[model samples]
Target chain A: MTAQSDQTTANADRIIISVDAMGGDNGPSAVVAGIAKSADKNPQVGFILHGPEETLRPLVDKRDVLSGRVRYCDTPDVVSMEDKPSHVMRNGKGTSMWSALESVRNGEAQGAVSCGNTGALMALSVIRLRKLPGVNRPAIAILFPSTNPQNFNVMLDVGADIRADARDLLQYALMGASYARNGLNLKRPRIGLLNVGTEEHKGRSELKEAHGLIAQFTDQADFDFVGFVEGSDISGNKADVIVTDGFTGNVAIKTGEGTASLIGALLRQAFEYSILSRLASVLAISSLDRLKKRIDPRRVNGGVFLGLNGTVVKSHGSADATGVSAAVKLAFKLAQSGFAERLAARVASTVELTQDAVELADPVPEHQKEGQA
Target chain B: MTAQSDQTTANADRIIISVDAMGGDNGPSAVVAGIAKSADKNPQVGFILHGPEETLRPLVDKRDVLSGRVRYCDTPDVVSMEDKPSHVMRNGKGTSMWSALESVRNGEAQGAVSCGNTGALMALSVIRLRKLPGVNRPAIAILFPSTNPQNFNVMLDVGADIRADARDLLQYALMGASYARNGLNLKRPRIGLLNVGTEEHKGRSELKEAHGLIAQFTDQADFDFVGFVEGSDISGNKADVIVTDGFTGNVAIKTGEGTASLIGALLRQAFEYSILSRLASVLAISSLDRLKKRIDPRRVNGGVFLGLNGTVVKSHGSADATGVSAAVKLAFKLAQSGFAERLAARVASTVELTQDAVELADPVPEHQKEGQA
Candidate 1:
């Protein structure tokens, strides 16, 4: 049995995931349908759905694949997309989002999935799941489609917090590397610090410092530290993991998505431009469909919250049934692999390694060092 | 005659643009061919080419379209891609980049186009032409293909300077709006402040301040302020001008390009996947070509240096003859419209309006304000 299953009350044969069933644009029905789709494909998966019982029970009953494997944690209140994180944290006891995270907090579920407001979800996750021992700030890590052999690259701190100091960036590198290892099944993922340029002297001073710190721990952490990478390298094969401050990462992620969406729209316009083009589009339907499937944003739907005590996956607020299913599948895989426990251990060991390195370099007693300053 | 022609030494009927014919990846031959193409299409355009006489004379002479319309300013030195901006500024007097800018400074050309290193070129432009009065920092504004009727959106501070405070961002809005007005022929452009979210309380403190500052000047500037816009709106029809700090703008620009390039690559892969797809590719060649042209980066190849005393267009360093022609065409259009003079007047008037508004709001003397602080 995995470390996560040891703590959970769930059956040894099944992995239980706590899911918030409300607040998505498509409503509870889409969430139910998504979980049902996941359950039908993965026999080892079960769910504890959180929402109003009357609303969710009927939806769950409609899916035969979800029978007997689903449990309900009914909470009437739902977090809206416009809700403030602070307000949600203060008066969230009866909310479905809060109740969903309760299952993970109490060790009843190994992982959690939510399609609520990202800020509120992140706030609640931090309060309930807590931070890993060595983590300063938690980050949102998402997988981006790329030309790598694995076909995806992991990028972190997409919008967890806007500010990251040198130490925070170093932790991101470590956390991002661990996520790639368990999430993408890479043995030694290459970690890259995102910058304006590849040159060592370019970018903010904190990045330069983070570069040295990340390189120092690469050998001990079992990840290759590729120096600095530019924005173009985000979708390239140069690095398996890209780390940056949340502010820059958030802008980069949104810009990339916007560009892709625009290209897709323009391509449709192109196929319908002329009669000959329309005929060609009809003949090329299967070819175009294959291309569409390859770059489909729905297939890569979850932003996993890293540096937390327990795993939580945040689905897009506007996610459809397919997008929610993708998130659920990702949560299940991470749970089965005991990603949370592995990440905790990885961070704890790195902190210890850093302290030892600091002591060796400075050659000063910890107590006496304070007086020197 | 236009305002640009009234100041230039060349014939009033011809708009002369200084062409830096060195430092690009393809060398002076490509630059000469690009100018030749532009000259053939535009009978009223002339060139003052800057490069080594021995190398550039033959290239220019080979193009019959450029005969009797090209003047050479022989400069033996060239700036390489690896040269630092500071180093270039101190020792780059003999380089083609400096000579090209000199032509603009001396009123021999209305604008200058260069495919040299961006840093060195920007540095040289600033040193030779200087910044417009009341403009704290200059910016590099590029045109992005968008869903607007004009087919492009203007984004500023792509990498002129990394940090933009409230005042700097406000200036970006003014400069970007002016660029849209003249470059895209928009009567009253809609400007948006780029942030992580559209909410008023969402981004960094500077963005919030910039939002307020920009809104105050919209009526006086003859543009509609669209409040906060996210990265997705960079290519959306919500705004024609997007303004942000150079750091965020640079990342957003590169991310958009990288994503577009990735999609293009994936499309090629999809069409080559099977026998039926290959047949469809042949049939849909024209349709696909239309799509390619619509979104082609080469077609929109210039990043105009805004808030400068003179017009300077920076082409992509790896640009080909077609790309170079596109940059030259953009420079010619901006010169014909006398964009630099119009932008300077717009900024000057806004600065005066701001001082008047501040005086009216506070009712305090500028000399006595320091004592109050």
Candidate 2:
């Protein structure tokens, strides 16, 4: 842990992270195993596991580390991986995924962590917790592997929705900056709007409008607005938070992940191609191991959904026990530092400027203004 | 050279590729140096160097491989990297960029290759060569390093225009598939539309429309339209051609290039970190060399401008001699196989479909229809 996290822990109250234990590809076993790992290390952490008592109790009981650290909620239904978001919304009332989020909504849990269908989890989070005041759209923020002082940089709107207007993009910059400040522990997280070019004249008109809007909030939001950043700057230290419409962000993240996976596969093939290369692989095993660990997607396993009354961290569905543990740890950290409340406060304060932003670029119709308000 | 290129040369005529020998980052020297390299190995390939005759003459005289085989066009004007496309179009006559394309326009050269500003090159290529009869907008096509049989996959609209409607996307599919068939020598190239997800119901609305349109063209274009593909397929061999709006493609390609560069930088740092690692590096030199060569950006150093009557391959402005040589080779291959005429022919065959696509998508405005026609 960094000194900032240590300082945060010293002042904050005990944090409980609710766990959705049923729908992950690895099932309840991985969730229970993850809870045990978290419980052993963080005494101030507690879990409210949501699943069928019959299925979860046996797994929780197998780990002595989870004893007295967990409280189970008997939710029998499970949202399958193939379930549509609309279907899950209508039928998911008694499911573990719904129960876990409801715990946060009802103030029973500080934050929720789920390894479920992304669309389902996002839909449930929005419907359960509702958007924060002044936030027209909630965004899903994730940490990309980086070469900065911080090992990760925050990127947001990774498919919460396919669209973002000038107003939504500005909101993302603020929300992403808040996440970077509290989660990554940057004092003034630098915010960059993702565009095709760093040049001022390039890209869509919305981006140019978003650029000016984000710039105005730098002094107010207590972060640096680092103009436009090209896609290359996402992994570099040039920006702490890279903001974009969910459509572009989603494609960029998937492309980076896909490229990394392809490179790993190619490296393996190269190593096994010849006896001399195989010998080299054996000799350079330590350095090669370091490289692999540095780029392993599993290490950066959680995507935090921001711009809501309550926070939710979506772990990868196919995550192993270690990945689930990482997500839980992230949720615990965000909860302990009172991130959800502070983020809500931040948005509420700057919201009038958000309205000002809309007026500046696009005027609201006099009749429609009341409805939007 | 791959067996494919060897075959292309065997059955093809002597090809002449025009070269814009000024305004690149390294100036005329690098351009001349690059032409020398391409001429030495490819016997049937020739060059028409365009620039100020006095400055370019000395450099061509330095290379014995270029004697008697070079054609010079005395154009004193040069397009600086800073010049805007609009500025170039109005005042760019006599510039090397214009002369290079003009050479192709007049049948003095089969294709044009330039390392000038991309926007300017694209603009000049459009104004001088004009769009192919059926092309609504010309796209900048690039070859991404991939694990395909050809070691590359073609991606288009990497920033020719920020906007692409359903009709424009359909044109890209037809144009890209044709390029893949001729340039990559794919009998039936598989085309994928870049999107946020592979699901039938995911992504923006135009994507759904574009998907349907491209599927309709698979039979007519003699290619396989492989529906939607996520970012992962960009580097994988899942599709031979990946198509998207210029905004998304530009960011994605930059992201991929930046990520690959970042990984390369990190790998070097890891290898040099410790004495044991340095020893391992010595032993693993062969494998590392192969890996380095495989991923080098210079090796895949050309972006082909499609949808124009003539071909113009844009090389990186700061590219060294090897990179420039790669661009020349690409231009030579396209020239040898009559790619420009073939691509124009392909789009001409689909000209009726192009009109149908626009009408199906959005009824043409009466005033604009005549101008568009």
- Point to the candidate with the largest DockQ: 1
Model 2 — TM-score against the truth?
Answer: 0.92
Cα lDDT of all candidates, in order? 0.87, 0.86
Q: Which regions of candidate 2 deviate over 4 angstroms?
A: A1-14, A361-373, B1-13, B354-373
lDDT of 1 at B286: 89
First chain TM-score in every candidate? 0.93, 0.93
True contacts kept of each: 0.64, 0.72
Candidate 1 ranges with C-alpha deviation above 4 Å: A1-12, A355-373, B1-12, B355-373
Maximum-lDDT candidate: 1
lDDT of 2 at A250: 89
TM-score of each: 0.94, 0.92
lDDT of 2 by residue, A133-160 (tens): 8998899999988788897889989988
Clashing pairs in 1: none
lDDT of 2 at A158: 90
lDDT of 1 by residue, A103-139 (tens): 8888878889998898899999999888988788999
